[model samples]
Target chain A: MNHLLLLLPLLMPLYGAIFSLFFWRNVELQKVFALQSQVATLVSCILLFMAVEDKGILTTQVGNWPAPYGISLVADMFSCIILLAGSVTGFAVFMFSLQGLDFPRQAYGYYPLMLFLQLGVSGACLAGDLFNMFVWFEVLLICCFVLITLGGSRPQLEGSIKYVTINFLASSFLLAGIGIMYGLVGTLNLAEMALLVRILEGHESLITMAGMFFLVALGVKAAVFPLFFWLPASYHTPPIAISAFLAGLVTKVGVYALVRLFTLIFVLDTELTQLLLSVIAGLTMFIGVVGAAAQTDFRKILSFHIVSQIGYMIMGLAFFTPYAIAGLIFFMVHNILVKTNLFLISGVVARHYNSFALKDLGGVYLKQPFLALLFAISAFSLAGIPPLSGFWGKYMLAKAGLELKAYALVGVSLLVSLLTLFSMTKIWNEVFWKKKPDETEVALLSPITNRMLHMPVVMLVLFILFISLYAEPLVHLAYRAAIQLLDSDIYIRAVLYQ
Target chain B: MRTIILSIAIRLLIPLFLFFSLYILFRGHNHPGGGFIGGLIGSIGFIFHAMVHGPQHTVNTFFRINFYGYQHQPTQSRSIYLMRMMRVNRWRKRKRHYLERRNRNRGLLHIEPIDLIAAGLFVATTSGMLGLFLQEPFMTARWVSFYLPFLGRLGTPLLFDTGVYLLVMGIVLKITFVMAEE
Candidate 1:
């Protein structure tokens, strides 16, 4: 039963991808299969959470091989929370794709690629081995390359070229890092690596170099400051549904990996790596928000903000304390829901006004009050307004920073929050409150776009509201996750000795 | 007429280069030379030949080596061949008309070695590097044995080397075909 719970989420998506590809000619069946598989995966995640709520940690050795020789799937508080968030957001995006899509014939491949990406995300979160994590990251990246280029327009191809090239370079760095680590330590299991790292604490410089390599690679993937040019150039070129999905989850996976590795394997070299991360985080937030301020396009602004929010998550990890790490986890969850919702709402606005440029769109709130309200809620939540999901995340992080006496970082974080609010309001005034453009020609929109756009808005808003109202359990979960991460012995024992 | 001799010289050199590449790939596990270097060497061989003999001749040679029957009697394998033909025809027709109208006074520039080299490097580098990067990152030393008559034991390193070689070759051939039509 334990093993079944471990395999269900992965197998469901794998089967769905295959099913969709084989039955590609039948579009309706493909949608049904994709949605059903996503729901099943989500349900499986919930079940696994319930089953392992009290258990210390769950590990399943795939193919019945020993720890270092075989692939292992792990479930801890951190992975379970990430998996749950991935599934819920993935399901919402799947529904949005079904309804909001305008070019189904060309997008026949999108569903399968999305399922494969989900498989990769789940696998990455659950993987206990270094090589397996690399494999899963590639799986997710390849699918993203395809999805980003699905429309094959000039902008799509250009964006894809940049996206693929940078991601490919990042993968090379990841491979090099893994190879060097394996060559030095003679092991590929992350837990084993953690043990070996502790045993070789005298050789801290080597480990620090390896940590830098992994950080840079994962940083590129997460859209960190210096390596973030590819993100804003490409993220807005994908179909709205793809944009929403990626905006919600992809970079967060990188942050998750960074947190996992630093907290577990490279804990010995924290000061050096953390200091570098702190400086990078500061620059990343400031630069990203400023870029967002300069952007006139709605989606582009949100895309730039993804880079900024990732800075906050990285800042939390840089603090390297239980409270700070817990705050990072909660903040990540909040950002995913709020960011994805904003992108989807932009899609709806685009549908109504036929433009994503802030200069071209206006006065949408006059007609669609529900959408306007949803947009306002998501934007405020993103800005960390009081009693919202983002507020708790920011408050906790600020508190954690204060405890660590990182006064400047806390101040910068607060300043970034105000800037975030300012930009969100800028989007609001341009997109919803201002006067509508005088265009005598109104292009008829499909019913699919109208219905599909609302699902993500409703689903994500409810998620934001739920997290705001019921922050206790989730916050507790985050604290437990942070504690488990800080105490590497539990993770090592679960993966190696269990 | 002199160009034909140069083409023959290049053709002869290709086999020698291929042999050296194979040697490098096999001994790469213990030394510096590996699949990536070997694939580049093999691609360089084909590219040199294409530079002297032209893209059509190069493609013809490729089809002969592979015995990919569709390239010889394209209409017979209509489904896949038709797609290939469509792409080739469209490219040629468009380029021919454009060049005829744009540069009627000057004759067409003969294919240059530098162009082939550029295309070859792009093809060989991307394909060779991507093959290695896409595989198991840390387990390059793990060997899998397969019994064969000539080679006593073949391993993953050799298999990956061969894969890189094929990828480089395919990419060069495809690029040559596309560039020729224009």
Candidate 2:
């Protein structure tokens, strides 16, 4: 029963993709089926989360094979919560896509590709071994390739080619790292590999080299400072629905992988590595918001903000404490919700204004006060205003940093929050408060599309509000996940049954 | 642009290529040849046919389905292979031409590439669900070892393989046909 729960989240989307592809020509059927399957995926992940919460870290070996010999699907608290976040965002994005994805793209297999991407994500989260994680990452990258290139527009193609090229390089590095690690440790199962790395006598420096390789690979995916060029270039070019989905979920998966491997597999040379990561985290945070501050386009700004927020999550991991890890978890989940919602709302605004450039967008506040309100709620939450989800996350991380006497990083975090708020206000002023452009025409969405768009945004906002108001459960969950992450012995035992 | 020898070679090789693809598909259950490669081989046959005769001729030769109904009628004038396969005598040339023209106008077969995809996916999913019904994880390898009269022992994995084979073939054909048209 437990194994099936772990498999269900991945399989539901796989089957959904296959089934939706089978009915490729029937766009309406595909839409309905895709949404239904996403909901089903959400339900299954919730069930899996419950199971994980009740039973500490569940591991299921595929084909009844013993762990360390065959592929295994394991769910600890961290992976399960992330999976839950993936499913929720997936559901909201599919709902948004129904109205947001235009007809030609829908006909061109968007739904199937989205489901495949979700499958890759869930699989990546649940994978119990190193090679399997790499495979899942490839699957995830391939789906992104197709989704980004679906329209065949020149910009889409240009962006996706860059996206694919960089990601392929990252994948090669990841593969090389896995190869070196396997050579050094003699096993690919993460649990067994951890044990082997600890006991293996020689080649300590070589293992550290492999660990650096993994960091660089994941760093590219997570859009950290120097490696983040591909994200802002590519993210804004895709359609709003695709952009929203990818913005919310994809890079975060990379961060999740980084946190997992760093916490569990690469525990050697902790102080030095943590120092290196802390520096990167600070740079990532500062550079991302600085880039965002310079952006005029709404989605482009959000894309850069994603990079900045990733810095915060990495900062939590770099602190190398249980409180910090828990804060990272809380911050990651919160960012997924708020970031995707912000992008979705931007899409809605674009739908009305007929432009993503902030210079051309205005009078939204006068025309639709409710839309303005929705934007403020999510935008403020993202900027770490108090009593919101982002504030709680930032608070926890800042508290942890202060306790560790990382005064520099804590100050950097505070400065980034202020810059983030400045950018959000800039957007608010330019896009909403400014007078309408005289020549530009603002179109109203069809009642159905309006309803569809509004539902997901409202639901996500309510969810964030709920997380803010009643954050105790989420904080507790994060704490437990953090403990499990810091004490890798629990993970090893759960997977290896030792 | 038709070369008589080239056309004849294509006509003769079509059956051989198709047979080879089937062989590859069947062998995929145990050996390395499986759905993806078999589908590629089959698509190579159609691609050759398209190159030799022209995309329009290939489209007329193959049938397709859209959301509504059959996309093309498989008949003598439209289907070049069907026209050549007929055994009309010289004495009945005029009447044969009329009949062939009429056959061209008639809908002899209504098959579409999408049907293969839909059927293949359905079958593959069903085979996977069989494991689920048996209270095993999805796509679990379960075999029935009983020998049949002619086909021998069959396993669920083979069923899954066949489904993939059909789906890949359908997809290849669909993509090749669309690309060949323009």
Candidate 3:
């Protein structure tokens, strides 16, 4: 029963995707199934998190093959927390997609694809095998490619080509890394490999090489400093519903992989890894923020912000402290909600003007003050203003950095936060404060869409507020997940030793 | 492209291809051939027919199945909003929607190739769920205790392979139809 509970979150989406696919001819019926499945997946995720909290770590072997041989699905506190957060975002995005995506796109298997993407995400989080995780990544990659290029518009094609090509390269690097790891460890089970890695003592160099491969591979996906050009170029090209979901989860999944690899399998060379991560984190934050500052498009700014905020999470991982990891966990969940909310909010704004350019948008405050309020709540949280989710994550990271005496990276992070605020303010000024641009018309959203769009944003805003008000429980949960992540023995014993 | 000899050959070979494909699919679990290979082989028959008879003719003849008409055609200016004419817009939309829905209600039922993919996914997931019922983890191979005369032990793996077969067939058909469309 407990084993089934561990597998439920991943299976729910699979079931839902299949169920939705059965109604492919009827878009309305598919939508209903898609939403129902999303809610079901979300509920199961909540259930899984609660189960993990109550039972510590839950591991299940697919096909009764047993650990080390069968494909193992394990839900540690970290994966549970991420899964829970991801499902919430998935639900919200699907809701937004209902009215946010164009009809043509909706008719073209959007809901099923979204469900498949969710399945990939949950599978990636819960997968306890290296090859399994890679397969999930491939699932996400294919889904994202189709979703991004669904319309096959000129710009969508251009952006998708870049997105697909870069990610294909990343996938190769991932495959090569997994191949090397399998060669070295003679097994693909992550927990068993963790145990073997410790026993193999002198192969630290080879292990680090494989680890570097992961860093680069996941870095491209994560949109770190040097590999993030495809993000801003492509993210703004797709429909808001699609972009919002991608912005919310895709890169974060990469960061999650990096953190998991470092804490679990690649702990032998902490100093070297820490040094390299800190540098990448610093540059990613600085460059990503600087890029955001230069963007005129609403989605483009948010896209750059995704890269910048990822730096903070990686910085949390680099410190190699439990407190820091806890902070990373909290920060990641916060980022997913706040960032997705901001993108959804941008979707709302873009719908009004039919443009993402800040210059082409204005008078939203005059037209709909409620939406302005919604945008402010998410934007402020994203900028790390006090009393919101982002502030807590940033505060924890800065404090943890100070404790570790890593003043340089801490300072870079602080400066980036300030610049993030600047970009957010720029958006506020141009989009809401200024007069309407003369050339652009205020395209009215349908009443049904108006209701649907606001519903998800308001829902996410409440979530942000809940996180803000009840920071203690989440902080504590993050700490617990951090403890689980740092101790690979717990994972190993649960999987292999039973 | 529709030469007499080639077309006739394709017509004759299609049955042979289909039979061989099913032969491969059933033999796949024990031997080297399985659902994926079987699906590819099965699709080859259609592809060959398409090459000789033209994609349109093959689609009209070979691909026709259950009716699934009444697609919710998007309303004109469905996304546009005008504040001043709000009530008028709503009323007009309501009437237009009713008329269009009724008109489209009588249209032909034509299921597209994408639906097969959905069916494929459904089958694969069902195969995985077979394990859970028996207190096993998902995707666990469950087999019948007794064997039949011609068929070997029946199990979820074979079901899973069939799912793959449908999925591959669907994807190939969809891609071919799309690329071959006017």
Candidate 4:
């Protein structure tokens, strides 16, 4: 029964995707069925989280195979946390797709594809072995390829080609990394490798070589510094709902992998890795914000900011303090919700104005103040304003940084936050506060679309508020998860000796 | 494209190819042959038939679902408007001749490749869940108490292999026909 609980999140979405294919004739039924599956997944996510909270950590060695040999599905606090946030945002994005996405794309297996994407995500999150996680990422990538090019517009085709090429490169890097790690460690299982890394004693350099392979591969996925060029170029080309989904969760999976490995398997030489990661984090922040400042498009700016916010999470991981790691987890969840909401809001802006360019968008403040307020809450949260979720995350990290006495890196983060605010304000001034453009026609939104677009954003806003207002429980949870991560024995024991 | 000798030869060879594919599919699990190779062989049989007779004719005989895809919208004006768009190359004009042939040949049974994919996924998932019903973890193989006369030790793994077979066959045929249509 316990193992079943862990499997529900993956199974629900997989079943949903399969069944949605059966209902290809009726798009409306497909929509309802997909929503039902997502709801089931969300329920399962809650159950899994509760179970993890109660039982400490849940691992099922698949088929009763001995540890390190068979596929294992494990859910620790961190994965459950990521799963919870992902399901909520996934549910909202599914709702938004009903109205936000155009009809033809919906008919072209969009709902099923979305469900498959969810399966990939939960699979990646829950997987206990490195190779299994890589397989899940491939599943996730295939869905993205089709979703990105569903319309087959010229831009969509061009963007998807770029997206595919870069991701394939990343996947190869990851596979090679996995091969090397397996060769060096003789095991692909996380817990087993953690134990082996401690025992091997002499091959620290080769291990770090494998770690470098992962860093570059996951760097591309996470859209870090030099490797992030594909993101802004392609992310803005997809439909807003798809963009929001990808922007919100996909890159973060890369970060999740980094945290998992660096803290667990790649800890052989933390001194050098820490310095290297902090520098990368700092440069990623600076370069991302600088790029966002240059973009005048609504979704484009948000895409660039995705890269920037990731740097903050990476910084949190680099510090390796319990508080910093806790902040990293907290910040990851906070960023997912806030970033997805902002993109959905951008979709609303694009729908009404028919343009993403800042100059052509305006008068939402005067015309649709409700939309403006929804936009304000999320955008402001993203900018790390006080009393919002982003602020708490930043506060935790900065406090951790201060405790570490990393003053220069701390100063760099604070400056990056300020520049983030500048970019958000730029969007605010141009998209909402300015007068409506004189020349372009404004598209009217039907009541259903109006409801569909705002419902998800509003739900996410409530979530952001919930997190900010009721901070202690989640904070405690993240703190405990952080402790669990740093003390790797608990995980190894749960998987190997349980 | 059809030649009388090739068409007659395909008429005799296709059934043999299909029979060998099923034999190969059943031979999977303990041996090397399995769903993927079996499906490839099955698709090869059809491909040969398609090359000799016609793709439309081959599709109509086996599948009981629509294979004609979403309508290709006439983009006469839009294509011109798109700066990057170019006219369909004349070298690909043979694609149109097949399209015209597709309209003329109507089969009573026609299955879309996507339908096969969906059905295959469903079957594979169901087979995995069967282990769950038996109180085993997902994708764990569950065999019957008694063996079948030919396919010995009927099990969820075999069901899973069948699903993969259909899935692979569907994928290859879909790509082949769609490309052949265009």
Q: DockQ of every model listed?
A: 0.03, 0.27, 0.48, 0.39
For each candidate, the alpha-carbon lDDT, in order, equals: 0.81, 0.87, 0.87, 0.88
Which interface RMSD does candidate 2 score? Answer: 2.7
Model 2 lDDT, residue B13, Cα? 81
The model with the greatest DockQ is 3
Q: Sort by DockQ, best first: what order?
A: 3, 4, 2, 1
In the range B1-182, model 2's lDDT, one tens digit per residue, is 48998888887887888788877877776678977788778767777888877654665566531122233355535565434434333323556446445554344343456667767876776776666666765567677878765434577777887888788878887777677768
lDDT of 1 by residue, A355-459 (tens): 899988887888788899999999999999989999999999899999999999889989999999989999999988988777534446676667677977899
TM-score, candidate 2, is 0.90
RMSD of each: 9.1, 5.3, 8.6, 8.4
Q: What is the C-alpha lDDT profile of model 2 across A1-498, one tens digit per residue?
A: 865788889878987887787676678888878987898899999999999999899887765568898788899999999999888989988888888878999998898899999999999999989999999999999999999898889989889878999999999999999999888888999999988888876766777778899999999999998898899989999998999989999999999999999998787878778998999999999999999999999999999999999999999999989999999999999999999999999999988888999889898899989989999999999999989999999999999999999999999999999999999999999999999776666786789879998888998998899898899999999999999999999999999993
In the order shown, the chain A TM-scores of the predictions are 0.98, 0.99, 0.98, 0.99
Instruction: Compose the digit string of candidate 4's lDDT tens values, residues A1-498.
Output: 666887899999998888888777679889888989999999999999999999898988766577788888989999999999999999999989989999999998999999999999999999999999999999998988988888988888888888899999999999999999989988989999999989997899989999999999999989898888888879989899898999999999889989988998999889989998999999899898999999999988999999999999999999999999999999999999999999999998888888899998888899889988988888888989988888989999999999999898889899999999999999999988999777577787788878878899899999999998888888999999999999899989998897
Which segments of model 3 are wrong by more than 4 Å? A439-441, B3-5, B66-112
Scored against the native two-chain complex, candidate 3 gets a DockQ of 0.48
Best by lDDT: 4
Model 1 error, position B26 (Å)? 22
Better of 1 and 2 by TM-score: 2
- Enumerate residue pairs that collide in model 1: none
